[model samples]
Target: MSKKLRLSSLIVGDAQADRVVPPTGFTARLTLFAAGAMAFLTVFALALSLASGRLAARWGAELAQSSTLRISAPAEQVGAQTAAALAVLESTPGVASARALSAEEQRGLLAPWFGPDLPIDSLPIPQLVEIVETEEGYDVAGLRLRLQAEVPGAVLDDHTRWRRPLERAAARLRLLGLVSIGLIGAAIAAMITLAANAALAANSQVISVLRLIGAQDHYIASAFVRRFTLRALSGAFVGTAIGALAIFLMPSAQEDGGFLTGLGFEGAGWFSLLLIPIVAAVVAYFATGSAARRTLSELT
Candidate 1:
């Protein structure tokens, strides 16, 4: 349409048209700094969103298919109860597999709090059993009833109480991250609009002369729009690069590091970062153009 043509012509601007806007000033600095700062924050917001999403999916997948069983009884009865519980689980319709944890494995779990040198054998620790579920999953109520009847010491923890809250928290964190990005974009647009207005006001004399020479309002507005848009694009590119570098330098994802270390781009996720600068430019284009047109109309 005519609007696109006007924008395109302004982008491939004439030297004379470009001269109307100052090459360097407060407005230029404001636009660049605003775009850069917002873009930098946006990168982190994007990372947080993606990381939380991955975390939620991982938690859902892992927890959905697995559970734990604890057997607490007198030292002499522990082994008997564990065997009874295993027998019950093995016959359960939806359970895929169940294994009692070795004393070494249980010791490893307690080591973080109890220390590596703690004498696990001397303590009356509860027996732990890991349970993996079939695709259809086990009937929790039925399994719990069976354990209660066959093995009084056995306790089934499907992780429902634990997993639901963690998954919900991760999902909300992802939502918050997305909301932060939207707010950042709005902040960028507001800053660019103010900068455009200031630049237009300062160049009122130049605008008058251009008008007197029969330059159309659209042509005059395009120059300002194009300048601000390019400034936003350039600044955003720099900020995004620095942000990505910072993320790249962070600790690599590891089991020990958990969620914090994994807050970064992985594989194809890196490619999405490239879109930030382009989005910033488009936002600046619309913001500056609207500001310029409104200011010019008022001047007339």
Candidate 2:
């Protein structure tokens, strides 16, 4: 920005000869490679955060309007308690449907723990009824009170005891993923700064010669800044494209045991992912630019 530097940037040199402080060389390539690698990793992390966020929302929504009624009475009274609980649920304004599990269905559920051949009929297992609620959701407290009076052996479980904590844990995982992305960006900035500083240090003699020939700091800095910024921008785009493709190629929800498939973004989120290149470019611009200006100012 100094007048001395302005004169140097526009000072025409040899028309056919190569540039004095020519475009970045090996260092730029290495820096770009590093940046790209980091960006690619960050994209996956971002996808994980976004996917987790979606999963948490869905799980929270699905658990909100459902409850389970358990009848733990003696064998003689289980059927009566289950029927009474179902009757109460069906009569409630917010209740959509209430149905007691059939014997086969109950046995199938218990089979997971009792093995495939357990005699469920002989076990002192409680009978369970599934309750579905409408949009407003049922008043669980009131429903419990009603169940206690007419079906003393029935217990209402709104699924809140475990649902809320699961949701919070999912949400926290999403936040942690986002924080990881932020740290990656910060690391990129720091790496770029170091590379820029090294480039500046290496070109001290060239800078002095340019200044001696009526060149300014801006000209010298612009050359380095433009090269680094472009490299970062290009590398980031390539990385983002690769990263997005990787996420796109991930298995569907039904595949890969529900782990890798859930590690990417969906829908319009890809557009946001594309912005990472621009952000990387901007970071490079500021980092390289600031470092150049400060270093040059100290000399001339």
Candidate 3:
């Protein structure tokens, strides 16, 4: 109990021992640069993860509860089939709304491929009807049966093939982003550990003198731990702030950047990122303390 109290005091309460040890410029810069760089990369990784999640939710919400009906009958029958499909959809229990695409809308959809001048009336293009599902989506099998009976030429496109792949890709991207954050954290810990070890080796004489003066291992270790901890916190804070600003400066989602361009933090994500500096400081504290104690244990 007494040992733990003394150790705690040495780590956070006392400062004389820290002043006794001269700071090494090289290790100081190394720690600052490493922590800053790692924090910057971590911010991006976090953004990627958050953005991917948003994309997945958006795609699922937009595509999951809707279906398309295509009527490819002869030109004479197209109008009748489209009307029949819309009527069936309107009468369907789980369908919220259904509308047949206008001539202008269909032409606009085809203009991308066939050029603006392509005559819509001349082409025997299939008529398209968009169907929106209610809170309880339509039963696919039942809808298929109704369509087959009422409109032989109408085909349902549930968008399942398209949606599944996009959702899976977004999920994978999110997973990759999380893995990247973990790697950045591990890299930061490793570099800080190496820096701490180097500082310990450089201050061997100081350690010897302090030990001879009746200092405990925790007291000796605290000096290095506190220095690295503060350095990491300061560096990480600056890095995170800079990163956040960079993200803020990015083109807005309204710019039509699709998936990758929309990468950035949302409401609560910003709050979570604020914890990076604290996490870096904690990691540095433990890493430096462990290195210090291990190095001190090997001394004569």
Candidate 4:
């Protein structure tokens, strides 16, 4: 006959071992509070990273597929050169559509820096036209050569020189946010380990009774793991909720021009935010279990 497995043969040894759980040992309640604070900060860091990534993708997509043509001939030849440039762009295979910006539109574009009325027409300003392209974009080298040969004083600015720097800055911000989350996670694990060791040291007498009664190593580890994991889960839950609320209460994109003001989770990104507490709890479980087993093994 096959041997039967006894689920009820409790490995905890002493049935009353539950009564020995101490209130103050390793991580004080203060440790949980600190962990919660760190988790909260991590939530914001994650949101910032995600938002910045989205912004970078949007900016890159917009700028990559667009180009600008500047017509800088004498006032008399301005119209002729602009027309010639438009004709060339229209004939170009990659170009989608070329548009010479209207005077009012030009004024609006400059209004942010120079105020509404800056004597736009009276000054000898170059004519500017916008070129929208297909997904493959256009051949800037070839187009510039064509413009130079056919339209004197014409220059093409695809905005690449300046756009690349903005993309890099956004990318760096994203990396910073990710690094912050990693550091926060590490801190949480360290705190849990310390807390478990403290609890084990404080309850030395309880551990002695449990071991004297034949408690398995797994049972001793479980006591510490269960307590620490529960604490971390609860703390992280409250922190995540508070962090999410704080982001929601902050000024939105419609209210602020500064990008920092609107930094937050958006759309389906909020769903991923829910995973933080679960991860914190899992980390605490493993950290506390390992610490307890190692410390107990020394005594054994």
lDDT of each: 0.89, 0.81, 0.88, 0.82
TM-scores, all models, native as reference: 0.76, 0.77, 0.80, 0.80
Ranking by TM-score: 3, 4, 2, 1
- Candidate 4 lDDT by residue in tens digits, 1-300: 111121122222334433456666436576678668877998998998998898788779988888899889888998888899899999998999999988888888889999987999987888899999998888889998999899988889999997899899999989999999999999999888887887889888888888898987677766666667778888888899999998888877764356786598889989877888888987887798789879889876
**CA displacement after TM-score superposition, residue 2 of candidate 3 (Å):** 9.5
- Span of ten consecutive residues with least summed lDDT in model 3: 6-15
Q: Is candidate 1 or candidate 4 better by lDDT?
A: 1
Where is the poorest 10-residue window by lDDT in model 2? 9-18
Q: Write the per-residue lDDT of candidate 1 for residues 235-281, one digit (tens) a residue.
A: 99888999999999997888746888889998898998999999999
Candidate with maximal lDDT: 1
Candidate 2 has an lDDT of: 0.81
RMSD of each: 4.0, 5.1, 3.5, 4.9
- Tell me the tens digit of each residue's lDDT in model 3 across 184-221: 88888888999989888888999999999898887788
lDDT per residue for candidate 2 within 1-300, as digits (tens), equals 774453344233222222576556789789879778887987988888888888788777888778888899999988878878888888998999989888899889988888888888898899999988899998888888888899999888898987889799889989999899889888888889899999889988888888899876666777777667777888988888899898888766764345456777778888888888888887887888899999999996
TM-score of 1: 0.76
Model 3 lDDT, full chain set: 0.88
- For every model shown, the clashing-pair count is 0, 1, 0, 3
